[model samples]
Target: MKKIIVLFSLALLSFSAQAQEIKWMSFSEAIAAQKKVAKPIFMDVYTDWCGPCKMLDRNTFSDPGVVSHINQNYYAVKFNAEGTEEINFNGKKFTNPNFDPNRKGRNAMHEFTGFLRVPGYPSMIVIDEKGSVKKTMVGYKTPEQLRADI
Candidate 1:
């Protein structure tokens, strides 16, 4: 009986490990991955304090179907809309020029977000392999909705 229980636990662990998961990476990492395999880029542009962004992460991104689809079809990127990190893309450097180091709540938007014309939080940007913007989806989206959009 103990051996059977151990075997069952091992099987459960292996199954969990094989479960589909979104490979969320930084913008630069996604770009590098695109160069290697030439897959489309799917970027999730969100803020740390945005409620909808958290919901999207929990509901849509965590869904097995969404995870499998994104992992298979695109290089997933997670970009903080109000972050201070510098991003170099298309021969230009982008940064959050007005980002405050002290203030808490909402912060200045990143330059790359503005460059991509993201008007609000929880924006989803899809880029072609050639580095051109293919589509920009705004607001919260369900797993089914995002799958259809993709």
Candidate 2:
């Protein structure tokens, strides 16, 4: 079982590496690259405790077709809304000072959670090439569903 899990993870990683190189860029990199690119942006808002987020990573985002489409049409940014990382966007800094580092789970909501206005886990915010919100989605989504959205 352990071997299977490891193999599965490795396979997913390899597929992710090949299927779509455009994914989860650092804040600064995303901002810089996206400014010059003509495609839209898909911001994946998630928390470690959210089961659906992991599922999306394992299933939906890993799909070769979905990955290809996203890579061609969007810049994917994985945002751990409850993470500890400090981020700056559009000349504004964002962080969560009250986030409990010692806590056991992914409950540390980032300051941008409120700013982006997403109210749920595994939320996907689609931004146009002009950096405007095109759509917002919460919970799990299949590759087919994502295709439909695009």
Best by lDDT: 1
Q: Candidates' TM-scores?
A: 0.90, 0.80
Model 2 gets an lDDT of: 0.81
Using TM-score as the measure, the top candidate is 1
| Model 1 Cα lDDT, one tens digit per residue, 1-150 | 999999999999988865657998988998888788899999999999999999999899988889989999999999998998889999999999999989899999899988999988899999999999999999999999999999
TM-score (C-alpha, index-matched) for candidate 2: 0.80
Kindly give the stretch of ten consecutive residues in candidate 1 with the minimal lDDT sum: 14-23
1-150: candidate 2 lDDT, tens digit per residue: 999999999999988677664456755566678778667778899988889999999888887788888877777788889876778776789998889877887565789888889989989998777657889998899989977876
